[model samples]
Target: MNIEWFLVLSALLFTVGLIGVIVRRNPVVILLCLELMLSAGALALLAFSRMLGNQDGQVFVLIVLVVAACEVVVGLGLVVAMYRRRLPLDVDEMKELKG
Candidate 1:
């Protein structure tokens, strides 16, 4: 596997995820996009690790996965809380926290 191709693929995924995060209005959609970005990052890291025969990249990917898991748990909790408060999933509808 050519390292440059892996890098390019990762860049493309990251760009798409960025667009999703910026263009979407729903909180859930943003979270899913964020996950996509993270996955692309992890894939790039894994590729580099394999190419270089280093364990550090894989370790970093593992750490990222753990963090992403935590984010999902907390993010879903927030979504549930929002629904309980009669809040729409749309980001523009959230105004209770504003001072």
Candidate 2:
């Protein structure tokens, strides 16, 4: 029931997500990690908002959720496109996407 507990959980989620993003090779897994990171941030924001007894952070968290949803849509679209093109799903081999 403490703000510190929420913050600690958020930090742990963020750390796990960071590690996943760094260690995973698959694009899908990377995207999932990125979502995890976003969720962690949103969780922290909600915690702070609750602690402060304000609506601002909740509004921002809503915006963040919208952005995260957009990111997932675009990311999955790209992944599907790549799969349709018979491209490798591995992030390392995605260097060809560089312009």
TM-score per candidate, chains pooled: 0.92, 0.97
Alpha carbon lDDT at 15, candidate 1: 93
Off by over 4 Å in 2: none
Residue 43 of candidate 1: its Cα lDDT? Answer: 88
lDDT of 1 by residue, 2-90 (tens): 98899899999999999999999988889999999999999899889999999999999999999999998999899999999888888
Check candidate 2 and list the clashing pairs: none
lDDT of 1 at 72: 89
lDDT tens digits, residue span 1-99, model 2 = 999999999999999999999999998999999999999999999999999999999999999999999999999999999999999999888876999
- The lDDT of each candidate is 0.92, 0.96
